[model samples]
Target: MSAAPPEEEEELALPRRPPPCHAVCSSRAFATLYSLVTYALVPAGVVALIEVRYAYLLLFVAQLLLAVGAVEWSWLAFRIRQRLLLAVSLHEDGPPQPQEPTEDAPDSSEHPPPPSSDVNQSEEQTEAAAARRAHALEDQPLRREDPRESYARLMAEAMRAKSFAIAPLADWLFCGQWYLAAFVLASLGAAASVALGYAVESSVFGSANPAAGWRMMVGASVEAAFVSIFCSSLAPSGADSVVLVVYQACVLVASMNAYLKLHVDVIASDSQVDPLFIILAGAIVIIVFRVVTSKVVMQSLLLVLCDVLGLVCIVSPLIAFADLIDQPMGHSFRNQFALFVLVVVATDVGDCLAKELQRHWPQVFQWCRHPLLKSEATTKDVEALAISLACGAIMIVVVRLGSGVSAFNAVEVIVLLCAMALGQWCRLWMAHVRQMAKVTTSAFYLSEGSRAGGVLDRMAVFLVAIIVYYPYIKQKYFSSS
Candidate 1:
């Protein structure tokens, strides 16, 4: 085996520097702590919230944040919806303007200069060149954007961001109708989750197969629906008989969708039309119907019953679409899975910060002089070990919270750490060994870098957890219904 070129090591050692916002805020250790703390807001962790005393306190904190952020959320969502509507309208208006002629193309003219009789076509080539230059000159006004436009774009982006990260809890606290909340939640919450995962991917693994942000958004929206349903199904309430049926139905419906996704081909369409917005539209229709029906001189209990049934109906089709899209659809109930997702975002952000700190300022970790830490390939190897450790810890915590501590649970955590660590070590070790020999023409590295991307991390953690906890999961959640 031949050694990889020096460029491979250089790439690993020097990633693109993060944005200034990240450097000052999310990169800090405090941000990692904040990430874990936000998990309390994830209503999907009801299994823990109901059982753990600490979680009860966290519930209050989560509630407080959500309630306070609603005003901000309302404003942000309104702006985003306006943008979405306008953008969609313009997109449907007409075919996009034709691209400017390139230098290689024929001259653009109503009447072309007769194809030059010369066989070499020198005159034709010159005319084409002149025409291309003219086209470029004409494009300058549209291409050269104004500074104010850039500022407005940035501000719009900032607003879109706030809509996703903030806002939730005290479902009744928001000013909008139920469907309005659902629409914004579906759009911003689902889109935010997708965006966070994408944000980490580039630094960790730049590859030939570029990630598709739109497909990811569609999928994340699907997962959002399922996760929310899972969390909502676990909501605690003191109810007798028939009311228990509502909660029971919620759990059954959720698990049913999970199975359908795993086993059935459910989604009828795979075109570019985003089913998420369509699902939200469906919810809106249902909500509007319920609202209009309430105006009649009917009993309040009947009205409440209709509202609950309408809510259930809305989620049913959303889950069904999720099964077919091979994507996650969440939102409508952002509190459920929204904050739990920060675990990935935080870990990725923190991991990059650590590497950045080590590469640029090794003195920060100089206090720890362990033998293993002394490797020449310090930056990349350490990053791999960090991923293995981080993945192991998150799995342990999440699994334990979902299913209390057990003998098998201990073994499961150990096995996962062993698998992840060995995988990371073997990959890095082989890359290092390969770098010594210069065996191949191509650059040899385990992946683009050792730092983990949040999207990959979440996928890896969940995949491992499913395999390790399949039996327990089947017995506890699936069979419970």
Candidate 2:
């Protein structure tokens, strides 16, 4: 066989170097550095929150940005690794060989065997020959399916299974099996945050309504649900689950000490039964029902009902305990509650809209075939930015006009907008890293197993623990009589 032309060989040559960003980001050193920076910011943020009480809302917003950014970054990393592995595999395997022509092909060049002796044979001999041929065919090995074809088929099936439309609450409830643990952790984290907030308010102002604690706990659960839904939308496959769960668990543990300090009295002096015990029992029953029931619809319905009840719990106390906080700067519980609900709904709607646009907008644009908008990446970027801006505007309006909350003013809106921008920038940086890693010369290099990222992650947990215990330490031996 003749060798391929030089031009063909050149065209087939792999690039000697990958994109710089990908090379850097994919390195173990870079991963460690990034982890260090992110984890360090947690303590710094906590310190800022302690020093500037009024910035609590801003801190909360920043925390959300950090969390979303981390999960997104982790997901991007997973994608980059998968792509790199696939590329390497394909490069090593090279192009596939053409298969031999099958009997069914009309254009097959091979001719059938002549039937001279078979025609002269008797009926019994012909029948024996046919059985022998059938046996031979059955003994032959089956041809393997082409890997590329199988991959394409799977991709098609996955795309078809994906619904660009936002799932109904019932559907969302039962969708991802891995999400259950994430949701539980997020809910616990939110509850702990509320507990900490109650502790701070009680310590500073001298008293707090127990009812407020209950309301805050429920509100936190709703917040968790909103966050979980948002993260799920971003990464449908299971990449972000680990980051989400770890971060939320850290938050939960960090607030534990403070939570213990301003804790709601679970025991009722008038009754032998503890309300806490009853609540725990009820929770266990719900979980058991969810696990034991074979009916998916029933399970989903039960979960949805639980979420609704949590929301109601948050809102019910607003009207009755709105005046519980007498601080001039303190937000109206009613307004904050309303804003939380608005955020949840707005994010859900926005995610659905984004998903639909992502799935269909390309087809719309392709049909038009505008030269300026030919790049799919550009179109996606524009769509994402537009959605983000629209969501931000809606949030600003909600904050500006919503009644009951005095704390979220124009300044808070501006802060939130800035935070959103920062989060987007972080995402862009992560994307750049991923792209660089994908095209780097070091693509073939294996990364050394480093415990740095893990260590940093544990550090975050430790920091939260200290925060939770700080209040306890102060109360235990340092109390002034």
Candidate 3:
């Protein structure tokens, strides 16, 4: 489904959250023949000789359709695996664990104990709802409903994602069929994405050189795979799951790139490989290990050495899109490579706390979240729990501003503010999951609205960052002749 404009997306009651900020032209996404109904076409008065597609456009369009199909096929394949595991799990472990909601349970929520007054109206309502849902859900156990019901519920909630469910590939991807063939199909889909990306940038866009094409291709492919893993659903699984996906894609790509760069240099003596590749690989590994390990992000040795590389993979696509409007956003893999190397690194990890070598930390590395969160915290005594996460988010923006002295982006600033506000709205969905506390059932609901918002937030920021404003590339490469 097409995404609505920003004004409509801001309204809470929209049917679907917006799509991800994938790095492709609007012509590729909308003006192509695959979606003929869009108003992007120029019509000649009935007796028209209009050039409908570019020479390679048809081929790209074909690949795009294939890409969509592959995505559904892959998701369905995993669903089969999930179904088997769920069935086996059910057989061996018996009915799913209950949330322990009973008539005797207190549906009414408790008073917020006085700890911090930063708790706002949003948190108050969210915690109250959490208590009520927890008690009420007890009446209807998860086992009573179908296990796959959660998956189906999410598919329905995400409007565009439903098309994949009904597609023929869904049935084919199910187990009890050619399991090996299904496996092969899964492998082929990933390969196709990487290959298509390389071909598009190198041949389709006609990059200045093959090296440039391959450079841009890495970020494009990683992002494509990343987006595919989550399916076309607006909702993402959770924070940890999301981080894992991004981390894996970035790590693997960065490693391959590091090797590739050195290999090219070895083959051509004059081909000077940037020393940054080595640093990029080192930094990404160390920082990923640090970020995923705990609640507080410990600054690794590599972060100091190669902080910009961590953001490069994700931001490459963002800046490339931004380069469309502003010239020389970076050196052309359509002009993102130079700035792709540039860093707007934020000091969100709080360096003052880091110098002490603080080993004791949290289970998750969030820039914004209170110190305490537990079972009782979801319902009662949330006064302390109601930390103004927005305040914490704002603190990070301040850090980012201080970090990026030049090239302030109004769009990014707006997105950062909107994200904190959006988090408050997501509290209801989050509270429900917290209340349920069923490991099996929580998977379905944890990603509810929060996941969609995360996806949309990233897309909006990522897309605007790229499609509108280009990162300032250093003058040496793109000096006006």
Candidate 4:
């Protein structure tokens, strides 16, 4: 490429300046207090609660701060909603009123004396001037604005934002609901297990000298459920839920063995001495479930399940890497955590690619009719599929070679990523709807020759998204890394 002009290069090379608010904050007491509360007190309290015996006091303070934060967030949301509503209402109201004619003007009945040759010529010039004045006056208001136009603009924006929230709900009805159900069930099951464990351990088992039976029942139930939920959410197909249920039951039985070992005061060091046999048995059951389910059920659920699993796969690695950076080695805790994230991402990508590949024929037809659809397809689809397959194959090889690898964290990350994607999708739909409405209103107003006003309003959105969110994302995700 040719080198850019000096002036253009100079413009591009401009340095970033701190935001006005950032500078103002350094000068203001209230802003400083706000910073202290959010950045200092809140985090300190949370950490103190986690690592200290006097944590209850900090926890109480944290809760109070949280209450204040919630109120502030709610208020901000309310204000935004209100402004949006008002803007919509105002658009529907139309433009400003036109100015009326003045009462203090010369009457048509007034007549001057009969003009000679020179007087007639002067009168003709005067009449032409008056005509031009009237024309200029007529165009002035059109150049300014009609208040009604503003109302129409707001109406369009309101409609768009409204539709964005609507479309996702409709889309979710067909595809997202089952995944939603699974997520809810897993979370609920976890909550129930925690509650039950706490209740039984505190009340039935007694902290001073708990009954082995009750403690085993509570601990086993909680741990098993955790494993089950984690496994099912990660699985591409099979009786995922059923597998989890079985795992929980088997673990319950194994808890008796654990209690016996504890009673004997056994301190066996090898992996074989651990109660991991129950976990191994659960995996075997899942493998069996996968085989049986393949033969019995239609594989539609597998596709959706895989997609959900894959999404978690992609995000998990990043989180694990983040964790690994924080964690020290020697007692290197679950290095596979990051790898699992990769696997989840890979699986999700694979699932998506497989589906996309399957739809290639249909996509071809779609592209024939909708050129834009073709343009939107990117390498991401292909890359994700390849990664997923690679992760799965690698896991298989690792298993065969007897190398250690954990896919759980990867699975969790992918799932959470899917949830995040869903949230973003919803937001995107809403934004698109709002833009369309705004553009339509702008177009209608522009038809009457309102160029500067229309462009200003249209450009504001692009500026905000680019100037705000893009930088925020870069800072959050890429800056440190």
Over the stretch 158-211, how does candidate 3's per-residue lDDT look in tens digits?
A: 322222221234345644232343344445556777776666554443333346
Q: State in Å the error of residue 4, model 1.
A: 54
Candidate 2: count of backbone clashes, pairs at least 3 residues apart or interchain: 8
Best by lDDT: 2
State the C-alpha lDDT per candidate.
0.38, 0.40, 0.34, 0.38
TM-score per candidate = 0.26, 0.32, 0.26, 0.26
User: What's the distance in Å from true for residue 285, model 4?
Assistant: 50
Candidate 2 lowest-lDDT run of ten: 317-326
Decoy 4 TM-score against native: 0.26
RMSD of each: 22.2, 19.3, 25.2, 21.4
Off by over 4 Å in 1: 1-80, 89-406, 409-472, 476-481
- The true-versus-predicted C-alpha distance at residue 473 of model 2, in Å, is 24
Clashes of 1: 21
